[model samples]
Target: MKLTSLGIRQKAFAYSMTTLGSSLINSLFSFYYVKLFLNRYRISEGMFHQAQIVFMLWNAFNDPLFGYLQDNAKVPCCAKRHLSILYGAPFYAIAFLLPWFPWRDYQEGDWLCGVQLVIALCAYDGMLTFVLLAQCALFAEISTKHENRLQLIKYNQVASLVGSSSVLFCGLISDNMENIFNFQVFALCVAMLAFGCMYYTGMNCVSQYEHVEKLEKDKMEDASNLSWTSVFYLTKQIVTQKNFLLFIVMNFFQVFHLAFLNNFMLIFADHLIPPYLLPAFVKSIMYGAGFICPQLLILSSQSLLRKLGYYKIILSVFYAELLSATVMLVLGPSHHYVLSMFLVANMVMVSATFSLFNLPLADIIDADLLNYKRSFPLSSMVFGTNALFTKPAQSLAPMLVVTILNQFDYEKLKDNFTHSEQSALQDLHGAMFYLVCLTPICIAVLQILAWTPYSIRDSHTDVAKYIES
Candidate 1:
C-alpha cells in the first residue's frame, strides 16, 4: 500500500495516541503503587509478599491468554487490532483508577490493604495486557519497512514525552504523594485523559493492508480447525526458538531494572540525598527528566540506532550502565551531586534503550513467520509469550527490593522518618546506596550475557530473501 505524506503523518499520529495513553497510565501505576501500598498504607511485609505472589501468577497467565484470544477471536473488535483498543480502552482506564481509592478504612498491617494491592495490580495488568497486546500486534502489522518503524518510534517517543509527564504532574498536584485527595483527583483526570487518547487512536489507526487481510482470513480458517494438541505444539515451537529464548532472558533483566527504577526512584532520592543538597522542585525536575530525557535521547539517536543496529546499541547501553553503576558504587552516596547526576543519566539510558525493544521484537516476529512459513503473523502471541517470561520481573523487582530494604529497618524508617535514630538512618542510607548501585550493575551484566548471542540481526536480510523468492 502506498501512503502519501499526509497519510503517513495521520497514521503516525493515530499510532502515537496508543503510546500516549498507555504510557500515562502505566507510569502512574509503576511509579507510585509500591510506595502507596507499602509506605502510605502500611501494608505488612507478609501481606505485601502475598500480593506480589498472586500478582506474579496473574501477570504471567494473562499475557498469552489475551494474545491468543485476540489473534483467534471471531468478533470484529478482537480480530481487528485497533477496534480492540477502542473497545478495551475504557475498561483499561477504569482499572487504572482502582488503586487510588481505598475500598475500606484499614489500619496498619491490615490484610485489606494487601487485598486492594492484589486487586489493583491484577486488574490493571489484565486490561493493560489486553490493550497493549493489540497495540503491539498492530505495530508489527502496520509496517514492514525498517524506516517506517523508526518513523513510528519517533512519533511514539514524542507522544511518550507528554504521556510520561503524568508522574511529574502527579508529583506536583499530589505534593509528591503526600496529599491523598489531590492524588486521587489526579488519577481521575488521568483516567479520563488516557481513555480519550486510546479511544481516538482506536477509531483512527488503520492496519488493513491486502496481505494482512489475506493472512487474517487464513488464520481464521486455521483457527476453526485448531485443536488442543496443535495449540500446544504451536506454543512449543514459539517458546523453543533460540532468538525468543535469548530475547526473553535479556528482556527479563531489562524489565527488572526498569521496575526497580520506576518503583523506587523516589524512595531512593528521598533517602540518599540530603534535603539541603536537592530542593523539591529540582528533584521533581530530575524525576521528570527520567521520563523526558529518554525520549529526547532516543529521538536524537535514531541515526546512531540505524548505524549501529539494535544489538550493538543495546549491548553498548548495558556496558555504559555497568560502568556508571560501578563508579557510583565506588564514589558512594556521600558524593551527593555526582550520585544524583549519574542516577538520572543512568535511568534515562535504561529507559531509552528499553524503548527500542519493540523494533527488535518486530524483527523476531518477522523471523518467526518466515521460519514457520505461516500465512499470518502471530504478533500478539509472540508478544504475549515473551511477556509470559518477563512480566514476573515487574512483581519480583519490588518484592525483592522491599525484602532487602526491610533488612535495614526500612519500614521503621518510613514510619518514623522525622524521629529516626541517626544510627538507623545511617544503616538505611548505606543499604539504599548499595541497592541502587549494585542492582543495575548486576542487571547490566546479566543482560550482556543473555543478549550476546541473539541472532535476530539477520532477520531483516531473511525478509529480503523471502521477498525475492
Candidate 2:
C-alpha cells in the first residue's frame, strides 16, 4: 500500500500528539516529582519504593483490564481513536499536580508524608494507568499498514519531542513553582493544543470505511461448550509456531528498556550536573539531535533495510546502547558539567541509536505476520502491548533509584555536587547509580541476547507463504 503525499502528511499529523505529548508529560514527572518524593520531601526510600511497587502490582491487573476494555468496546467513529486521549489529558495533568498541591501547603501533618504518598500512589497507578495505556494504544488502532504505522510512530515521536522540548526550554525561563516563565501555564496550554490535535487527527486522518469477509466464531460465553474448545484451538495454534513465543519475549524486553531509560534520564541528569534548566538544556540539546537524526536515519534506511535487511538495524541499536553504557561507565564524572559536552554527546548518540532501531519494533509485527502467519488488526498489541511490562518499568526504576540513594547515603552525591543537595541525593545515591547505569547495561545485554536467535534474514517472509497456501 503506497501512501499519497497528502496521505502521508495527514498520517503524520494524526499520531503526532501522542508522540509529542507522551514524551513531554512523562519525562517531566519522571525526573522532578519522582525525585521530589524521594529527595526534598524526605519520604522513606522503602516507602517510596513500596508505593511504586504496589502501583505496578495493581497495574498487573489493571493494564489487561484496560486493554480488554479497549479491545472489546465499540467506539464510534471519532470516539474510536480520540476518546481516551481527550478524557485523559486533563485527568493526567491534574493527577500530576495533586501531589504538589497537597505537599506544598501541607508539608507537615500528623501524617503529612503518608497522606502525600497515598495521593501520589492513586494518581500514578490508578488514574494514570487508564490514560497511559489508552493513549499509547490509540497510536496503533489508528492505522494498520506497516508503512503507515512507521509514519504514525515517527510523527508521534515528533510530537513527543516538541512537547518535551517545549517543557525543557520553558524550564529554562521560569521557576516551576512561581510560573515565572509560565511553565505550568504552558503545560496546560499544550494540553489543550495536543488534545485538540488528537481529536482533529482522529477526525480526518484516515479512511474509516473498509469491508471485510465475515467468518463465523463462537460466543465468548457458554464456558462449557466454547471456552475449552477455544482455549485448545488457540493453544494448538500457538504451540505449533515457535517464533511467536520468541517474538513476545523480545517485544517485552524492548518495551522494558525503552521505559527504563526514559525513567532513569531525569534523575541522572539532575545529579550528574546541576538541576533544572541546566540539565533540561543539556537534555534538549541532545534530544534535539535525537529528534532530527533518527527520523532521517529511519526514512533513509528504507533503502538500506531493503538491501541490508532489518536484522542489521536491530543489531546496530543493541550495540550502540551497549557502547553508550560503557562510555558512561568509563567517563564517570571526569567531564565538565557546565559545558555538558560529555553528557550532550552521550545523549545524542544514545538517542539517535535508539531512534534508528525504533523502526524494527514496528517492523516486527510485519516480520511476525510474514514469519508466523499471525495478522494483528492493529500492530499495537505487538508494539504498545508491552505497555504492560514497561509501565511497571516506569514505577520500578524509581523504586530502585530511591532504595539505592537511601542505602548509599548519597556519598558520591555529597559535597562534590552541593552541600544541601548531598543529603537529598546522598540519601539515595547508590540507588540512583545502579538504576542509571547498571540496570541499563543489564537490559541491553538481555536485548542483545534476544536478538541472537531472533534472526529473520532468510525466513522474514515465512508468514506470506502461509497466506498464499
Q: Highest lDDT: give the candidate number.
A: 1
Candidate 2 lands at a TM-score of 0.73
In order, the Cα lDDT scores of the candidates are 0.86, 0.50
Show where candidate 1 strays beyond 4 Å. 209-213, 458-469
How does each model score on TM-score? 0.96, 0.73
Deviation from truth (RMSD, Å), model 2: 5.6
Clash count per candidate: 0, 14
Question: Least lDDT summed over 10 consecutive residues: which range in candidate 1?
Answer: 460-469
- What C-alpha lDDT does candidate 2 achieve relative to the native structure? 0.50
For 326-373, candidate 1 gives per-residue lDDT tens digits of 998988788999988987998898999999999888888877888989
RMSD of each: 1.9, 5.6
Worst 10 residues of 2 by lDDT: 211-220
lDDT of 2 at 283: 59
